[model samples]
Each structure stands twice: as structure tokens, then as C-alpha cells.
Target: MDMEIDLSNLGTVNTMFAALFSKLGVPIKTTISPTVLEEAMNGIVTVRPLPVGTSATGKVDKQCAHFFGVTISEEQAHSGIVVRVTSPAQSKFKLLYFEQEVNGGYGLALQEDSQKTGKVTSAGMYFLHFQVYRMDSTVNALAMAKDPEAAFFKRLEGLQPCEVSALKPGTHIFAVYGDNFFKPASYMIEAMCAKSYEETTERLKEIESKILAKRNDLRQFETEYRKALARFQEVTNRYTQEREAVDDMLRERDNIHCSFTTERTLVNPVGAGCSSSRYTTEHSIPESPENGSLDGRDKSGKKKWFNLNLNRSDKKA
Candidate 1:
């Protein structure tokens, strides 16, 4: 088939796609640059899930696929790159890793152009970042042993303490004995607290930001965590969009008819000749998505990462 695309002037295709999308009422985010897309494509297409065209999940289509992303540029020359990250899910966690490069120098030009046009502000190749903190049983034991106010059996009056291990996900019942104690006392305490797991093991990060003013308290920790959490959520939401792009098949993955504008709308759209329509009109396009936000974000019209302009946030992926 004469379906191969001339990725040399990939920018024109991006402009066209964006123009068409705006007319379709499906707003999307294209952080990856065209240069990245062209470089990644070269002359190859069809990566997975689908065998033809560039199918992906979109803001309008939310199902039928699990990954979708597009790269757009306005430099007339392929000089931009887009990055997307995804979290590990299902039994195929390895397939969903923390980083996936588009390879070559595609991402570099997009960042350089971002410095020039400011269209793509943030540099760094976008990659899925998972903030997973491990909770060690030793830490808990050490904390209890170190704290004078709650150490040993002084609080319990008279009892020798046993070194406790990591917090278990079930109930606990144990006995305590001391050197000069009268006898052993058996205590049964039902520990059904989800906080132990949720707060400690789930999401955690490091401390190195000038915004929180530096501290060693709950408030400080929370402040730092929330800031990073926002960014992480942004990455997750963007990566999830790939599902839509893959489902639409020929028309949705149109390399020749893709574009973005100053107003955040797509242009050109499908039918600039994708040859993908050979399937069926009611081929059931995959569900990409409608609103692309974390909370009230993509929905509430909140400012995106570009608006932040943080010196640190400016750091590339």
C-alpha cells in the first residue's frame, strides 16, 4: 500500500492534526515533539495492541487500548520530541516501566526548540515516575525503642519487650516478659489500621525543595509530598491517553493530518488519506478519554505544568 508517510516535514502534519482535532471537540495534550515522533518512526509503524496504523487512546476515546501519545511541532522541520510515562499495572508490570525513550536525537531538538519558541517549555524526556516508598519493620522497631516516652515496659509498668518486626497487615497478639517482672502478661490488641500501610508504604519522596522552607514535621513532609504528587499525577494522566490514540486506528493515528495551535485545539484531522478506513466505518474506535485531568485539573481548566515555570520543574524529564 502507498501508506508510508514522509516524516521529513513532520511539523506540517502536526499542524494539520491539531487543526482538525479542534473542530472535533476533543482537546488533547501533545508534549512530545514531532522530531521525536519522526525519529522514532523513521519508516516503521505499528508497535503493539493493533497491527495497522498508529492507533491510540485519546481524550475522547478512553477504552480499547492502554497506551497512546502523539508528537507535534511547528518549526516546519522535525525538531521536537514528546515524552510519555506510564505506571506499572496488572501482571505485565515489566511492560509498564518507569522510563521508555523514543531513541535517537528526536527528543533533543524538541527541547531546543522549546527554548526558542517556548511552545514546549519543559525540557526533559517525559517518563513515567513512580514514587514508591518501602516501610521497613526495623524502622518501626527502632522508632519505638528510641522514643523515651514509649520505650520498654515502663509505660506498661513491668514487662520485657520483644523486638517487633515490620507491621503486618493483620491482627497481632503477643506476650511480654521482663527481668525483674512478676510474671508474663498476654495482651491482645486488634490492629486494623490502614494508615500504617497507606501513609508509609504507598507514596513517598525525598526532601529538597525551597518552597517548604525546610522542616522535620508532619506539615513540612505533607507540603513537600503534595507538590511532587501533583506533578506525578500529571504524568500518569498523560500516559493513560495512549489508549485512545491506538483505538481509532487509521484515522486517529493519521501522521499527515495532525496539528496543534496556540489555542490548544487540534487541526487537519483524519481523511487527509490514511488508507486505514479499509476496516469498517463502525469499527468501534477505542475509548481515548474526554477530560484529561488529575482531579478538577483537565476538567476545571486549571493551569498546566507550563504555567508553573518552576526553576526545578523546568528540569527535563
Candidate 2:
């Protein structure tokens, strides 16, 4: 059966085609009958074009794609999405349109074939490959190679405006890739079976709101941490000053005690005889004790006493 798939309107064409193919399985010779072909041709699906100036755009790098259909960052070889379309076996899938905005004037190159190195040029001539895999396939493109099929299937890329005739019916993964050295590129992409522009726009807004909220929370935490650190420092400084003052007082007390001990030693000699030899006084010493007591006498029968006489002159040595 003859069918016309117009992709001129890059915005809405992919959506219409996706809806159409979903109802009509892959047009295989064995399964697609003449009646089904006619029905598909007559039944045209129309999708509303995204409102003017409402198209959503996003950034993609070799590492990740943000706010776009699918993203692969430089750190990763590929990015994927699990897509469930109506006619998985017979659908004619296409990536009708995409727009890219770049930063730092860096060009992006997408690998068209897994075995070959995709070329790069100063001009923004980049290509993207899509690979579709069965949903049940345990092989994860993001994971390390477990087997040859998993490895091979994971690296596979498909042409844009992808032709899905060869894909089998069921849930599948759609993976995108770029050249190994592809720089950070910002672009927007839409797929035949992907969400509508409006839906994507809304989803992006929700994601942005969540990110902003998280940022605010982090800022608040940082402010609180700084304040706490300041308080701790103040306490430490005060404690150090108080401790130093106490140390100073103890040192002064020790010095005073030392000085007092030295003065007392000079004033009263420990073993020197306290006779008129050291100190002289005008008052004469009594020859004997009045009560026959020897309270001030030393063991040698000499009196040991300090005589205080203000009128006495200094004695000769």
C-alpha cells in the first residue's frame, strides 16, 4: 500500500508518525495485510505543534543531557531511555528534527557506526546514533561488558529519523551517542514516540523547581555552619585568655614567696651565734642571770641574745 509520511513540519511530524505507527505494527510482508495498509494510509494522525516560542531546549555533554530528550556525557559512551510504543514490531520510527546550541564554539560529533570513527569538522556537522534493544535484555549499556551480545548491542547506534521496521515488538531501549571527543553541546531533540513538547516543558519546570529548592537548602546549611564555627572560635579565645591570667597569678605568687624567704633568712641567721660580735648596743649585758636561769645561754655557757641599745655605736669586727 502507498503511504505519504511528510516530515516538513519538524515540530509535530514525529508525534503524528509515532501515533500512527503505534496502531500499525511494522509493515512486514507476512503480517501487514492489504486491508491494514489501506486503513493506515487513510487514518492520518495530527499532532498539535508546540506553541510558538514555547519550544524547550536543553544542554547535553559527553557526560549527560539536561532537560533534553536523551543525553550522553563525555564520561559515558551512551545514554538511553526505555520506550514502549504501540507497533514495536512494525512501526516506522523517525527522529524528524533537532536543534543544537553550542558553547565555547566547540563542535559535536556523533558516531554513526560503531566500527568506524565519525569525522569532526569546524562546521557544526554532528551525527547521533540510536540503538533499540529489547526490554527483557539483561544487558545494560551503562554497565561493564558481561557478554559479547550485551556489549555489541549496547554500543549499537541507529540513524536519525530512525527506521524501526527491523525492531521487534515489545519494550525497548533507545540509546544515543556522540564522538569520543565531542565537546559539551546544548541541543533539543524530539522522538516519534517521545513525550509531546508541552509535556516535556512541564516536566522540565518541575525538575528546575526541585533543583532550586535543594540549592536554597544547601545555602542555609552553609550559613548555619559558618555561624557555629564563629561561636566556637570565640569561646576558644576567651578560654585561652582566662587560662593565661590564672597562670600569671600563680607565677607572681611563686616570686613573692621566694623573695619573702630570702629576706627572712637574712634577718635571722640559721647557725650564727647571736652575740655582741655581730650587733653592738650601748646597754651593758648583766654578768649573771637574776633568777639563776639559763634560758638564753648556749651549750658552751655563753649567753646567746640580741641586745637592743639605741645609743650604742657600731662595734669593730
Give me candidate 2's TM-score against the actual structure. Answer: 0.24
**What would the per-residue lDDT of candidate 1 be over residues 174-241, giving only the tens digit for each residue?**
11101101121111111122232334322222322221223234445556666887999998888778
- Model 2, poorest ten-residue lDDT window? 120-129
Candidate 2 runs further than 4 Å off: 1-212, 259-317
Across 1-317, the per-residue lDDT of candidate 2 in tens digits comes to 32333222224556455445534532211112233223223432122233212333333343222212233223222212222211112212211112232321112212111221133111111111232221111224234234543343333221132223222222222222221122433333333322223465356447645654654566566577668979999999999999999988876666555544212333433223221122333558676644454753453253222332322434531
lDDT of 2 at 32: 20
Q: How far is 80's C-alpha from truth in model 2 (Å)?
A: 13
Each model's number of backbone clashes? 58, 10
Best by TM-score: 2
In terms of lDDT, the best-performing candidate is 2
RMSD of each: 46.8, 24.6
lDDT of 2 at 181: 20
